[model samples]
Target: MGLGDFADKAKDAVNSDKGEEVSDNAFDKGSDKLNDATGGKFEDQIDKGKDAADDHVGNE
Candidate 1:
């Protein structure tokens, strides 16, 4: 991947404890925005998506 992506991945790894919430909140916000925009069509996948997103962030 690109340097920016690598930098972000490293940052997230180093900041994982605090970053967990940060990542989760970001994922949740994105999910909420998408769900709201789509009128709940994606509601079922929101939680799983958020969890997967957050896991990826924390996985390093």
Candidate 2:
């Protein structure tokens, strides 16, 4: 498949219930890791970024 087709499929998958769950878990883990690595120094920024990402992927 072409890049556009792949992207469309990916978008569809991410809009599914299972995909939203998976995406939420991944975002939580990744944000937690970043917070830990930075000693929570940038927790606010990281959370904002995480929220934006979740919204972009239609998680909520």
Candidate 3:
């Protein structure tokens, strides 16, 4: 209904197991595309950032 409520629901969804799987898959696919376009120049760095995000979400 409200912005806060919407944000809360989104946060809850993203913190769920299914949501994590979906998020990781999406991020990996996108990262792969970017890495391909850049000839793998930033793949490792991209992975590190994604991993950090996953760690933060998992901790929550």
Candidate 4:
């Protein structure tokens, strides 16, 4: 992996102790806000993008 990817993995490890539920909730809240702001026009894409991000960030 590149240096940035390594750094991100390290950060994820450190924050993993916070527990998965916390991470999931935070992402859900952010997604909700984005959907609300956009009037649900991009709801599906936003949800999918959020899921992908959460997966990458070690939330799932």
TM-score (all chains, Cα) for each model = 0.63, 0.82, 0.77, 0.65
Report the alpha-carbon TM-score of model 2 versus the true structure. Answer: 0.82
Give the per-residue lDDT digits (tens) of candidate 1, residues 1-60: 999999978786746777766676778789899899999987888868777767667535
Model 1 misplacement above 4 A: 1-15
Q: 6-58, model 3: which lDDT tens digit per residue?
A: 99999899888888888878777877888899899998998888777677663
Pairs that clash in candidate 1: none
Candidate 3: stretches off by over 4 Å: none
Q: Which candidate is the best by TM-score?
A: 2
Angstrom error at residue 38, model 1 = 0.2
lDDT accuracy of residue 4 in candidate 1: 100
Worst 10 residues of 1 by lDDT: 51-60
Candidate with the greatest lDDT versus the true structure: 2
Q: In what order do the candidates fall by TM-score, top score first?
A: 2, 3, 4, 1
lDDT of each: 0.77, 0.92, 0.81, 0.82
lDDT of 3: 0.81
Candidate 4 weakest lDDT stretch, 10 residues: 13-22
